[model samples]
Target: MNLMTLYDDVINEDCSMIVPETLNTPHLVLRYFRPEDAERVAELAGDIHIASGVLNIPHPYTIDDARDWIGQHRFLRDHGEEIIYAITVRESAILAGAISLRVNTEHAHAEMGYWIGRPYQGYGYATEAAGSMLELGFRGLSLHRIYARHLSWNTTSSGVLTRIGMVHEGVMRGHASKWGVFHDVHWYSIMDDEYYSSSVHADHPGRDPSGV
Candidate 1:
């Protein structure tokens, strides 16, 4: 479907906002979080290594935290503020991580963010999921720009952003403080025109060009 079709699907008779139910990638499925997934989410996200690499995750993440986070998804989506997907393996339906886009509807832009569990790292899952999100943001949501930020020391995340066709947008020195230490932040982004022109879209055969 084109943007208009996707846009209409995201709204119902009452005019409340909603996200596409699912987005598929070659080895993964992006879907909304379920209450049952909370335990696993806490298990994977509680790793100190996982929390240290990103700005927001608490090192001691718990199931309650996961539930709390998941609980906000619907309210946020209904307000046109965010979309968060549980990234799961297609074959086994196992939760690998989470990805999100915080949107600014009036500006037609969004910020992308994601993380893969330690056990699932280095398998290209994050990259695949991120590319699909870019498609949903630009093609499905008709967003003008999608940007992401990462800790400067996290070269792995920077590489994923680059592989997905995002341009390096510079860094904010001492911009983030996590666990009491200040860290610099690297920004990256891809515009609508840039995304359509990039090889990233053509490389993902599983992604439906018609939008999620």
Candidate 2:
């Protein structure tokens, strides 16, 4: 059976528990963050290069900031507002980055966001983790669409999205402000049908609870 048929078969079933606490891929383990991870999160995210590319991360990210952010994951996930995962190396369990889907359950859609630590940038961790999230969003959460946006100048991020089969929606001129400067942003999305039909979706690493 194809993914769309599988999606239809399981659409009305209770999928709240479908997503595992940890999603495993070839080289990474996407899991929930713990309090002890705060220091490492601060260390990695504090880099000026990491902060400048994203809108929300502050340049001098602190342990307290990381704690505050990690502390909210449970409440947000339990309430169906967001699902965030700490991207870790499979063998070492070293935290490499973070990824999330800010879900709008009422609309059956979500926005994807992520960042990899400076040390992990070139290894395709972002793409692997993102592909898992797409599976979680579309297959597990039953979302109609999943979209992501990045600063227009961040071509690397755009490449990741494209590599995962997200179509370029368009650019929003001066759509976001970071560090007091306005910047354009590029938007990309994949609908459920598009996701199920794509070859990339077939190869993405994740356990399909629905047996698609």
Q: By lDDT, who's the top model here?
A: 1
Q: After superposition, how far is residue 141 of candidate 1 from its true place, in Å?
A: 0.5
Encode model 1's per-residue lDDT on 1-212: one tens digit a residue.
Answer: 22352555663444345667889888889999999999999999998888998778897999999999999998888877889999998877889899999988767789999999987887788889999999898877888899999998899999889989999999999999998989999999999999988876644433322211
Write candidate 2's Cα lDDT for 39-148 as tens digits. 99999999998898878899799999999999998777766678889999886778989999988766888999999998777777888899989988887777899999
Query: RMSD for each model, in Å, please?
Result: 5.1, 6.6
Q: What's the count of clashing pairs in each model shown?
A: 0, 0
**C-alpha lDDT score of every prediction, in listed order:** 0.84, 0.83
lDDT of 2: 0.83
Question: Clashing residue pairs in candidate 2, if any?
Answer: none
What TM-score, over all chains together, does every model reach? 0.90, 0.87
